[model samples]
Target: MSAILESADIDRALKRISHEIIERNHGLESVVLLGIPTRGAFLATRLAQILKSLGNEVPVGTLDITMHRDDLRLRPPRPLLSTLLPPGGIEGKHVVLVDDVLFSGRTIRAALDALGELGRPKTVQLAVLVDRGHRELPIRADYVGKNLPTSSNESVKVSLLEVDGHDSVEITGAR
Candidate 1:
């Protein structure tokens, strides 16, 4: 595997993304962060910590789209994870869906479907650590940490300390 982002690079990208979210939203008063399970949840928690440092207490939650995925029948079904939300729910609040990487956009679509059942948010936006463009769907992220041009055969791997025991990102396959 070839390294694409180092720990420091990941930290910087997240810092920038956090600032952009606050700037675009004008503040974090109505912002709610929901991380797509696995690495996304770790990133969301990191973002929440950064926002907290800025005196804004952001609510971070996890959203598992395993069941909402359209390819459920194509592959073996895995155990479903829990979908946790803040106490107040997302109604009338701006929700940001966080993920480690944006590949085909299918995951984001599944996430949207999952979110719909929870509650209606005033608006829903997407944030990803890496945007290796190869979108099969029309969806796009509102906030992207890094827009890395890539190919269809390549794969992007994100490693987080909370889940992966380290913080880094790598691209594998033909370059």
Candidate 2:
């Protein structure tokens, strides 16, 4: 496996993404960040902390899209994660869906369905740590840390300090 992003690299990318988000939204007013479960949740929390330090306290929450996935029938039973929304809910707020990686785009699709059931938001955007670029759906990320062009045979692994005890992004598989 080859390491593409080290700890410092990950940190820098996230910070840049945070700044872009602030610039695009004209500040974090009425902005709500909902992280897709697993690594996405941790990334969202970190982003919230970064945004808070930057002077705006944005609400961060987790969105479990296990039930709304399109390939549910293909996989075995999976445990459902908790769907936590910040106070005031998602109604009329700009919801940003954060995830670790954006490959197939199905996860984001499921997230949209899950979000629809919760409440109507002013707008919905997507943010991903890595975009490997093998989109099965038309979805795309609004905020991306890094765009790593990858082949279908290769795999990108993102290790975050929150879960993996370190930070790094590695790519493995036949080149």
Candidate 3:
């Protein structure tokens, strides 16, 4: 495996993304973060903390899209995660979906469907740590930490300090 981002690099990238988010939204007002369970949820928490430090408190929540996934029958059954929303919920607020990696875009599509069942947001955005091309759907991230072009055979792995006890992004597999 080859390390594409170290701990410090990940920190810097998150910080930059935070700043961009604030700037793009003209402030964190009415902004909510919904992280896809697993690494995405952790990243959303970290982002909320960063935004808090910047003087704006953004609500962070976890969105489980397991049931909404299109490839459920193609793979083995998986445990379901929690879908927790903020205090005010996503109604009339700008919702940003957070995830560790942006690959085929199927996950994001499922996330959108899941979000629709909850409440109607004024807008929906995507934020990903790594965008490794190969998009099967027409979806894109509004805020990206890194755009690491990679082959389909290669896999991108993201380890967060909260879950993996370390922070780094690695790419592995046949080149």
Instruction: Give the alpha-carbon lDDT of every model.
Output: 0.91, 0.93, 0.95
Best of the candidates, lDDT: 3
Candidate 1 on 45-151: residue-level lDDT in tens? 99999888888899999999998999989988789886899887899999999999999999999999999998899999999999999899999999998999988
lDDT of 2 by residue, 35-65 (tens): 9989999999999999989998999999999
Shift of residue 163 alpha carbon in model 2, Å: 1.1
User: Which candidate model has the greater TM-score, 1 or 3?
Assistant: 3
Error of 2 at 57 (Å): 0.5
Rank candidates, TM-score, best first.
3, 2, 1
lDDT of 3: 0.95
Candidate 3 has its poorest 10 consecutive residues by lDDT at 166-175
For residue 165, model 3's alpha carbon misses the true position, in angstroms, by 1.2
Write model 3 residue lDDT over 9-65, tens digit each, in one string: 988989999999999999888999999989999999999999999888899999999
TM-score of 2: 0.98
Candidate 3 has a TM-score of 0.98
lDDT, model 2, position 103: 97
**Candidate 2 lDDT for residue 83:** 97
